[model samples]
Target: MKLIFGIGLFLSLSLLCYAQEIYKESMSLMGSDFEITVVSENEQAGAQYIQIAVDEIKRIEKLISSWDQSSQTSEINRNAGIKPIIVDRELYNLIERSIAISKITDGAFDITYASMDKLWKFDGSMTSLPTPEEVSQSVARVGYEKITLNEDEQSVFLKQPQMKIGFGAIGKGYAADKAKEKLMQLGVKGGIINASGDLTVWGSQPSGKAWQVAITNPMDKNHAFTKLPIMHGAVVTSGNYEKRITLEGKTFTHIIDPRTGYPSQGILSVTIFSEKGELADALATSVFVMGIETGIDRINQLPNVECIIVDDSGKIFTSKNIRINNNEN
Candidate 1:
């Protein structure tokens, strides 16, 4: 009777493990749910790895987060235009990358957008369009060139007094990348790090199948546009569907173009596929602001980078090598 009972328990456990389901856990960290999903594995080990990933992500939040009043990034902001503050190596590297991207994009991607005055409100309170003068002045302090970086000392300085830098565009991606690294180091066979909508995945399904991720339709949130098979890389999406303001019959998106000091218009959503989550995250925002034509050109110039763009009229455009799996289930 004891042997029979043990065999029955083992069979029950095997049945439970074979069920096709999304094994997920949510942790309150990095100002949101640091979500992890594994195809099928040891549940205890998965949960432990996710917890460790969340801890690492929150550490990044503390390092690069600008919204947090007590973060080290705040120290840099406080010292802007007054003194240069030496930052951690990680943040120093991220800031350096941001500046480099900004230059590469000709200031289209800027971290100094915090200096813009609250000229355009998308919170359903905007009544009229910002005047030309207001738009020009808003971007006056928004120049990546003014951001000074010292490589040897690992320091950052803002030339203007009111200038400030925020990682809102790339923080989530950075966290996701860091979390992915930690999980890989811990010997996780299969896992995903999803920081909000920015996500990176690795390994394969238990049955040795590639992991597939669905791209949601911005116009119809209930539906997916396509499912992309991801083996070991990252994907990031920037969309204007959730945040927009209508002023004087003109619709403005939440994605602000730093060079023009106005919200980006035309494109509805932009998705970037890259080997590095941080680059994918920042590029998604940059390309969304750059619009379809220029965006595709820019992405094509970069190696191992691809993009999919949906315009306001629902027209879809993709880079040369992007393959869309349209099996909607």
Candidate 2:
């Protein structure tokens, strides 16, 4: 029910490539742990840049957080069936993009999933599986197709009274991307904005090497199975290893399929690589919900995007473009 292992899902395995000091600051933001790191020998400048990143993340949280009744997202949810809620262009664009992603994933990734009531618990509170009828009712109010958006007014409205939306699946990655963009705009050469596990990287290490990302074994998270370099890009890993419940001797992951209203199965972890953290974050969850073959097929069709899937049996699967052992950076 809680978070991380979302993007920077794999243990962040950035190697210290240069002698330049790596200054990092950690904070809890948007109900998740966030670590912002920048490479610079000047301690003062690094601290300032980190603070700037922190501020940007906080700004994003206030704009999109559903937990805060004052946020635009909450407003949209409150006015779900009553009237269209006008929102800032930034949020409108974000929701538009989210819907686009929903179309691509065929409802595997949905923001309207927030309408689902707490039916399954992973904290040992859930001992029995929800009946199929209960599962169906849980997702009755959740559907991307039910969302109505007016481009002219830049407004959002839910078709159902109980319908709601949230960015928990993609918010961290969006925050990471925005923070990285702001830092880069300020002329920060190289650094990492890791929102929980949703991570974005740019520039080069002090040694002039591209940033490298390592994939963790679903069986053994501490041991990375493969490492790939992603410079000026983002990588997000969504794993069911940490949040799951076993009922009737069947293990169910926390990633529930909004379309089916059942917990996701078959895959233990999904890691997506793309130029944007927002897309990576959404795709990771989508692929996890889509299962192995379909997820790999979907990722194969997308350009400049790749994914790694670990199934329940601990089998490793990667997209066509990914070279398992060879260095592709």
Candidate 3:
């Protein structure tokens, strides 16, 4: 199951100036809802800018989609353990970054987690936990180290035949980043590409102020705990509250720890603010699996990155840099 985040609902009023008009569009992409907003002089110009973003995101989805049999990603998976498959430089670099992140998080953020068998189901069908042996066997082929990349040839190889890689963790964020870059290149002064909950924004809103993003409360999705002004940056939230199951009086979330092949515990949600969407997305998932203390410590070591973690008990823990509006801590 994929992790869901409470969408940052931004409520902005339009300005009087026609040159600073804010045009918005919403559509479904990559199995999630994507909303694109552009601050432009006219509606037609905004539509063109949005079309560019949409096309760029579709192009990225085609390159990294694992379900599409003819995609480059699928071809790479098809040759797993048999031979190395050469791929585009963009994909190769993305995979390379994924491995680096896996190392940084100590294997907590592994793309090879796709190879994990579905031993634990979050759906209502699950009545009890799997046996210890069953749990171990499920992650037999799941390891970031098993993915071998040849930088010279730009090829990827899986050590095991059953090993596979999926970008469910970071693909949307990458798409958002790429789309934003494309818009900027097209001379878009201000816009937002919100790929599901992983969002990237540049420039200010039509009101001549930094974009206001409301961080929704995990306990209450309708209400926001705080609103932050983002001039230019990315924000990603990973939460387990939406998809979970309770068995034997114990609750299990949808986010499975790549190292343990088990659902994460204690953390209900993790929201990360960073300069890059891909980094924010991966770190959000890493924080969930790393637990509260270790995750907070890890995030603090990195510069220009902040995180807010909500535990099962509804207590909020933040990195040194984060400042909530209402709460002093």
Top-scoring candidate (TM-score) = 3
30-75 in candidate 2: lDDT tens per residue? Answer: 8888888898757898999999999999999999999999999999
Q: Candidate 2, residue 176: CA error in Å? A: 0.5
Candidate 1 shows a clash count of 0
RMSD of each: 4.8, 9.9, 9.2
Candidate 3 pairs with clashing backbones: none
lDDT of each: 0.83, 0.88, 0.88
State the lDDT at 221 in candidate 3. Answer: 85
Tell me model 2's lDDT, rounded to 2 decimals.
Answer: 0.88
lDDT tens digits, residue span 149-209, model 3: 9988899999898888999999999999999999898878888888776679899876679
TM-score of each: 0.89, 0.91, 0.92
Quote the positional error of residue 20 for candidate 1 in Å.
12
**Lowest-sum lDDT 10-residue window in model 2:** 9-18
Q: After superposition, how far is residue 284 of candidate 2 from its true place, in Å?
A: 0.3
Model 2 off-target regions past 4 Å?
Answer: 1-20, 326-329
Q: Estimate, for each residue in 177-207, the C-alpha lDDT of model 1 and write its tens digit.
A: 8888887887666778877767798987766
Better of 1 and 2 by TM-score: 2
Angstrom error at residue 131, model 1: 2.7
